[model samples]
Target: MKSLGSSCSSRAAAETPEASRERRAGRGALWSAWPRCAPRDLAFCMAALLLFCLGSLFIQLNGGPPKVLLELRNYLGESTYLDDHGPPAPKVLPFPSQVIYNRVGKCGSRTVVLLLRILAERHQFNLVSSDIHNKTRLTKHEQVELMRNISTIPQPFLYTRHVHFLNFTRFRIEQPVYINIIRDPINRFLSNYFFRRFGDWRGEQNHLIRTPRMKDDERYLDINVCILENYPECSNPRLFYIVPYFCGQHPQCREPGVWALERAKQNVLENFLLVGILEELEDVLLLLERLLPHYFSDVLTIYKSPAFWKVGNLTGTVKKSMPTLEALQVLYRRMKYEYEFYNFVRDQFHLVKKKIGLKSLLPISSHEPSFLRELTLHTPDPLEEEEEEVEEVEDDAKNWLVQP
Candidate 1:
């Protein structure tokens, strides 16, 4: 019986070791299969993830979405569906893909357009330059048609034309980013006056070809006589040229007064991305590069290149002559609103330059009345020889007929 009891105890002890090993192995398997976590800990982790997601959504709503996210969204939005069961997905390009340059004539537009030709190829953006240069003011129907036409252009396109400001918001269409350039009002007038009569380096007969109907006397009209004697060409409304480009197609825009001036200034503030000064063209290009890098990247470099300069030199008006100081004073007094608008744009441009850490090559005095003095300094030297080109006066005969 003692031997039997001892054998049973030994057998139980040996089974106990095996049973313990099996239990330990089961516990290890359970641990490996599923991680153990306290209910509170799991809840905290879930709450933290939810909070992070909510914060990201809030940021995306308040601030604009990050560029990476925008690109991703665009990609997803543009992705093709494998199944042809549903309509194709809509594509939303990043902002400022559609740009409009309602170019004001003789404001270094030709030069900018020339540069854009090169940029369009390099950057792979569509450049739609309108051939219609003369007609700026358009009828309401014409505006709607033109707007629709412009909207149909493919994504990431820049459309340029010598047209007045068209209010896209008025037509319930998406507004495109607007850009333009303006020069000193008097300087612009002088440049146009000469350019029309002597049509750059294209040829001596370029002016006649442009304005075939222009009488020899009208074509050869003197700048001083035009301003001092109140020639219809140099008169009001006709002189009120640049403001209309910004003031939209309103009839009052053609009038030379506070209403037109104010509307133009407001448009410039609200719509235009940039309205550069022709006098500081290099600085303008720099600003354009900084502001709209996609369209104008390396534009400054291209402008400074030897090839661009060779092309630019050909476009300089052959017989540009500055008006006499008396005539300039007269012209200045006549274009009071024009100068005011010019000064306002200049101030705004300078502010932007300062914001972007660009130093102006020419220091502009703070005094408002120094425009005539500054004009004298900035105006091109009088050319001794006469060359023929079409003038705005001959084409815009009806505008001059209207009494101011």
Candidate 2:
């Protein structure tokens, strides 16, 4: 009986070891499966990282999305100031003024907006605006909505801010006189370059460290992508992509497609007006005073820059020659169509200014264009008399007046 009991105990002990081994094998299988599962896990992690980086980059680029986000958040619940609860119905903005700010990046757009806001406080015009700040890349629907909203606002609007040329398409009923301000493209581009380059370094520590080297082929996609992340719905026609749209090129051909494109183009010309502030701010102001008599009575306030306030008339002195012959040609090839379009708009503006008696309001100097003089006046042609001559006083002692 004792031997039999010992045998049963031994059999049970042997089975226990086998059970433990099976459990160990199951754990080993789980470990082997880890590498196969790791990729999905890594993908999720990588996507999260990209989103974080993009968000950070956009905030840095746009100069604090935090403030804008806060404003938007507040606005979401209270759709309009004219909504039910007596927040003062959006009345006809008393001033019969239209806003046509030719916004160059980093060229005092914010200051202009602030200035307009301040002016609004003092004046009684209704504040009419779509006010889509930091929205540089927009779909057609959004553009339509923005115009539609602004169109309904009774003028003269007390104030509108952050509006661009394309926004004039909404108003069929009331046509407001257009006003805009422009800076030299070169100066504007340089200012924008430095602004993005330095602003990120100072504020956020290499957040915008990816400053794109200026390209020759007119490819600005690198910079455009950076700017677009933040301003997803901006319809600024001045941007590189929108140039095609503004010119009535593809996607905006005015055929079976959208009338929005054609409307936007005309509004940029007729409804939108720009004062070339780059050439002469004072002259531009004088013109503005004449045109916007209701808004300007005495000397209008000028916005002073915090930095570079006393910087001399550096704008003219800083001459940027075209990148290189090869580069210039390449760029011309890529952007010739848009360049022609821009020139067309520029000529139209010139004509409009002349008709309105605002030509003198533009800055004119006796100083001739040095580059033009060098290019046109001094070009040496083979047909012209050769300036280089070698005198031949021959080996002969006596020289007669002889024609060789």
Task: Give per-candidate clash totals.
Answer: 7, 14
lDDT for model 1, please.
Answer: 0.84
lDDT of 1 at 342: 88
Candidate 2 has what TM-score? 0.43
Worst 10 residues of 2 by lDDT: 390-399
Query: In candidate 1, what residue range of length 10 has the lowest lDDT sum?
Result: 386-395
C-alpha TM-score for every candidate: 0.70, 0.43
Give the Cα lDDT of each candidate.
0.84, 0.46
RMSD in Å for candidate 1, one decimal? 15.1
Tell me how far the alpha carbon of residue 349 in candidate 2 is from the true structure, in angstroms, after superposition: 4.0
**Cα lDDT, model 2, residue 360:** 46
lDDT of 2 by residue, 23-75 (tens): 89999999998766577898998999999999999999988778877788787
Candidate 2 residue 97 C-alpha distance from true site, Å: 4.5
Best by lDDT: 1
